[model samples]
Target: MSGPDRVAGRTALVTGAGNGLGRAIAHALSAAGARVILVGRTLGKLEAVAAELGGDSRVAACDTSQPAEVDELRAVLSDEDVSILVNNAGIAGPVRELVDVEPAEWDEVFAVNVRGVYLMCRAFLPAMIARGGGDVINVASVSGKRPLARRTPYTASKMAVLGLTITLAHEVGEHGVLVNCLSPGPVAGPRMARNFRLEAERTGVTSAEAERAFVSRAALPRMVTEEEVGAAAVAMLRMSGLTGADIDLSAGMIGR
Candidate 1:
């Protein structure tokens, strides 16, 4: 299970890379010999991940959801010829019915999950196109397709991500940019724990019980791991011509 890492020539910018799934993918890209730039809002966390990677890895504490910050970060990366962009930044909007959702909360979630992707693509895709080819991997979710109940904002945001992936793929195919989405099911991480807690509050069940219910939807008896999601992301990095496609690393979750 070993071969030469071919990503040495590539430079990858991973957003939300301070922890969780973002951190795992950053590590994977680095392990595969790519120069990785870790981007997140938390300086301490991003620094910690960068130190662990222990290469020429760089860190930029930038909140992807903020247009000004995204622009500043883009300027910081202007010198580097970024060849791969992994839009992994996201937030879980409040778990509530569509009518009960707050406008502020909805904007908060979309600003990060949806608008951030748009800004990043706009900021970096031109350089990628000019350089000949690149990868724009958007981290989406199963709820994007199956529409998880009581999570209107999160679901809608991801559906937008899915649609964006497809349309961007078509728009940039002539420019050698491959746009695709990675839809992961419940993964064992802090985000999943938070989701369980939210579900418990919504359903009057224990977090443990809610977690089991979530996993039961998957074909497997358990949720997937962060490393598994990282592997899926790395796989997407190596493939081409998969524009407008979604690779669901959902452990076969039954679609509703």
Candidate 2:
């Protein structure tokens, strides 16, 4: 049970598995013996990750924002046994003031972050319930718990995810499905790098300076890693009795 044998018989569907936290979680689950289905908009990136993992790893190119694409993805997975579902695909757009943000951009953010999660759950949860039990992990953010200035779209979408997680957990608890959310703090991923660059442009500061300022807001004064978030996801999947819980993997940032 040292390697893939631990999760050998399990199947996992990870959205946004092309990079960042989703990629890390896919790798982790695969290492633990799960057959990972990597879903993302980029086939090349997903295939690259699948090749690296080997052994039952699959790539499904999907723009989660599109309902038809999501339905097709569900049809593609119709015959598979998926034990774990990680709703990790998301976007952190420009940090614009509420009034200054374009309406379309705001809608797009919710389309991916909120609607995508809902569609995935709708597509997979029935099978999971029929099979007796499964785990669903939503990758929310600290902003979901507290309001952050200049990121109305991202924050609002994450909040919606938190609500969805809670309701789904309650709905499926008796059926043996576990639904929970992990609110990660400022993790040093490509998204964070992009956010930093945007901040630099906004304030006329260097990217390095913006990153430093961003990290300073954290109580730990350091960014969390993808492996750390993956570990939390693994824990959630392994916990049979937990549901409707918001596990904060923020390195003690929320209360402070």
Candidate 3:
């Protein structure tokens, strides 16, 4: 089949766009002609990306976990008419056994992965439905599908996202809004590198060795790429008939 049509004239709000997959998605959307809004906590990083996108791009620096800040963000965007919302802001926090995990750490994970997406959807979905139709892509993880060894908080947060996506898809499908979760297996990005580094520190291995070990667990025996995930997000956004589905861009690891 031919590639999806360019999203020209559409406006997209991408959170966690300061780096990694979110940044890649923002670039892809901008290149596809969407008027992109880069949202993240770091103004300098967001501004740098905004500068690269050039046309009709804006940056909003707000911590997604804060409802008041999200409200301010909504007020700032009240007139922009956003047609796409990508809830990509997330945190892995510290890896620890569930029994040993602190309540505060769990809350932090939920704050960004679950609550942040909830806030973004609540703020943007109305405008999208009002404008006729739109796409909402929540960036989840393979951890959401099944438990990982020491990622209790991260896993829980992503599972919540998956549930949220399904629930919202049902609520908004008739209104022409598509909601879905994009679960990527270990993508080769800054975030993945950080995760690997943390694992290496915990396991007493070199970072390179740690990454190699982790990639070996994947069916493809290789790490996925940010561009690949970005492409999947584009595909999901264009899939008008698809909703409430967990799209796995996992490089053959889902069933394995």
Candidate 4:
């Protein structure tokens, strides 16, 4: 796809670009003419994604949850004018009842999903503001706004992202920055497959049955694809006037 030209010359830094939705978003941004920077905890994975983009695309290894690592990452790319920041690095915490969740596990979830966003924005937003404008797209989830049994950590972290996106928009808009979030539903991928298997084991049902129940709850009766989520991110980037908004790319299941 020739993609949109709005971001053609911009540089976009996408955390978690090593795989899944993050990888998809990196590709979409590259195709839209942005010089993509693939950032993640795994060096090899990030390098692989950068190779795929095969241009001015670069790679940086950083565990966003770690403040030191994020600071170093900012230093590493200090020369690059990153006009877009995609905060997509995240992990699925253990799926279990709230009572069964460990405090450390809950902290781990918030560290990556919530604190990671805070650290990235803190590191990059000043530069963006100095340059006079930028775009930030935080990858949240539909589970944040809806009830998802046995996923308190993940859901709560995502809900925090929603709140962060809107309020951050309020704080940064005066500096010409646009901050928004994309809340995707069950995206068809290995991650969702693992979730299905876990749910099946917990509920004493087959994985297929678990998957069916999930998709069946959506108005479209299907899971959204990673590519769709990636495309949505690019679309959000192209919307120049949009800010403080949560775009639900949940296959019509958002309100259900």
Overall local distance difference test of candidate 4: 0.93
Better of 2 and 4 by lDDT: 4
- The TM-score of predicted model 1 comes to 0.94
Residue range with the least summed lDDT across 10 consecutive positions in model 4: 1-10
- Candidate 3 clashing pairs, residues 3+ apart or interchain: none
Q: What range of 10 consecutive residues in model 2 has the weakest lDDT sum? A: 1-10
- The runs of at least 3 residues in candidate 4 whose Cα sits more than 4 Å from the true structure, single-residue gaps closed, are 1-4
TM-score for each candidate, following the candidate numbering = 0.94, 0.93, 0.94, 0.97
The true-versus-predicted C-alpha distance at residue 96 of model 4, in Å, is 0.6
- How much does each candidate deviate from the true structure in C-alpha RMSD? 2.6, 2.7, 2.3, 2.3
Tens digit of per-residue lDDT, candidate 1, span 1-256: 1134435668999999999999999998988888999999899999999999998999998888878988898898889989889999999888878999889999999999999999999899999899878889999998888858888999899999999999999999888788889998778888889888888987899999998888887778788888999888888766654678888887888443
CA deviation > 4 Å runs, candidate 3? 1-6
Q: How would you encode candidate 4's per-residue C-alpha lDDT over 1-256 as one tens digit per residue?
A: 1234558889999999999999999999999889999999999999988888899899999999999999999999999998899999999999999999999999999999999999999999999899889999999999999899999999999999999999999999999999999999889999999999998988899999999998998889999998999999989888888899999988888873
Q: Which one is best on TM-score?
A: 4
RMSD of 1: 2.6
RMSD of candidate 3 to the truth, in angstroms, is: 2.3
| Tens digit per residue, CA lDDT, model 2, 52-160 | 8998788899998888998899899888888789999998865889999999999999999999999999889999899888889999999877867799999999999
- CA error at residue 200 for candidate 4, angstroms: 1.3
Candidate 2 shows a clash count of: 2
